[model samples]
Target: MKKSTKMMFFTMMIIGTMITMSSNSWMSMWMGLEVNMMSFIPLIYKMKNNKSAESSMIYFLTQSMSSMLMLFSISMNSMMENKMMILLTISLMIKMGAAPFQMWFTEMMNKMSWMNCLILMTWQKMAPMFICQMSQEKFLMSSALSTMVGAIGGLNQTSTRKIMAFSSINHMGWMMMCTTFNNNLWIMYLLIYSTLMMPLAWMFNEKMIMHSSQMMTNMKSMTEKMNITCMMMSMGGMPPMLGFLPKWMAINSMMESNMYMIMIMMIMMSIITLFYYMRITMSTMMIYEVQKKWMMINQNKNMYTSIMLTMNLLLMTMMMFF
Candidate 1:
């Protein structure tokens, strides 16, 4: 796509998300979702990649069906009806790519470029999750199940993108749990999650990486390896890392709310997610390299990589006072 055209679609996409988030009615939210989808599909395509085009189609169809369901539920004469609420919740879960409703999400992510993948993983989630509402039981069930599914789904996968897709699902579960307590908590979780993801995604995109094996053989610099390792560990929500802070806060909130059952489930699945994260970084840690910098792509190491990595640790430090 041309620069101007891309910019236009991107702006519209942002506006669409804002519309949905700010809308006071379900009908308006549904309209915003449609606008967002229309704009995003264009951005997901490349000049000649038929796979990307196919991915866009899948994304469109899935989102369209979900939106249709959402509209139908909203059009019901009484919004308070139990059946309408259930249908609305299901549609939102489908749109958010929560567990048992995320097959399209995984398929779409596999064929997308890194930038598109980042948008799908982070930005695209905002509108649906922003408006998500349901009973505590539904929230708890979605949270526990998504966390477990995400953790198990990534274990046997070698594709880096697929792993990240699963990781997003895992974090989606956490954010869902966050909703059970307070909206601000999930917003905090989302911000922290996005912070950890950006640099890792950048590194992968720059290196043209698609598998864990690439991290071992492709990233030759020690700095590269260290950065990637720490980021992955943090992403896994391990202690003393930035990612752990949000999960920690979430668990604390759940504890205060007496949500012990789902809390334990999330913690166990988190450990499973950490295992795959370890698998990805273990080889890099084992290998010794003498290169003095991060990847030297375009003949210059992007200073922002380390800057973002440091930002993570700095955030982790805030956990000490809490």
Candidate 2:
């Protein structure tokens, strides 16, 4: 019964995002966000972590406030076009956990399970981010700020989920920047980001790894460690890996558009972001720790893991042409 109920909410949550994505009007989009919030609040609860209850509450209040602001802006559209657009953009920014409005997001992520954190980082942002993309000028300042905050904020983090949360904010910065070039770039960015996140989240969930320290201690399998470390590098936009492709395209687009100041700032911030990713790998890379019996005993490659890792390489190839 518990599992079935969770699945039901999960399906509804996906449907809610679809509704907003497909909506032709502002009011309908707001309605979809409401549906999304209603469904998501239930899914945040976990048997082991009572912190999820508080996380869900904060998430609810934050999302509801955004929704109210959006609906008001939508309703008053005829009377105030410029002001309403600003209002609506702010609402969406709040919804997507972009910085300056991101306090609740990291807290919630810290409390939630890896699966819930994955959904919060990826799927839940799609609708609000899609709406925010429509307003390019307003999006720029927020995008820049997010990049800066995400880079600096992640530096001291030990919690793996919190690190990923900040990473999501950083990528949100990049994806928002992509919108200025056009819509397709951000969509491509989201798809690629989602692909890279799955295996990392699964690894954390499987090993119950929470902190940066645990990446070395808890993950006993070399294959698991190697795959995760490489994925982290790819995510940080190391060249030749899949994650770098979108950043590469975004930078090229910015250059073509003559966005020199913002481009320099974003590039600097990205290097900072990559540094923490490297820091996370140092534990697994530098150490010659005692091998556990399980490390040598287990040689079976998981079919799902093999497929995901293979897709990582394949995607790098396909996305370049795409």
- Candidate with the greatest TM-score versus the true structure: 2
Give the range of the ten consecutive residues with the poorest summed lDDT in model 1: 292-301
> Which digits, one per residue and each the tens of the lDDT, describe model 2 over residues 1-322?
2889988998999999899889888878888888899999888874446697899889999998988898888888899789888888888889999988989899999999899899999999888877876555457898999999999999999998899999999999999888877558889889989988887788789789899887787666666667777888988988878888889889988999899999999989989999999999977776644475655545434744685569666766677676
Q: Model 2, 89: alpha-carbon shift in Å?
A: 1.3
Alpha-carbon shift of residue 83 in model 2 (angstroms): 1.3
Root-mean-square deviation of Cα positions for candidate 2 versus the true structure, in angstroms: 1.9
Cα deviation of 194, candidate 2, in Å = 0.1
Task: List candidate 2 segments past 4 Å from native.
Answer: 135-137, 293-295, 299-309, 319-322
Please give the distance, in angstroms, between residue 139's alpha carbon in candidate 1 and its true position after superposition: 1.4
Candidate 2: Cα lDDT at 143: 94
**TM-score for each predicted model, relative to the true structure:** 0.93, 0.94
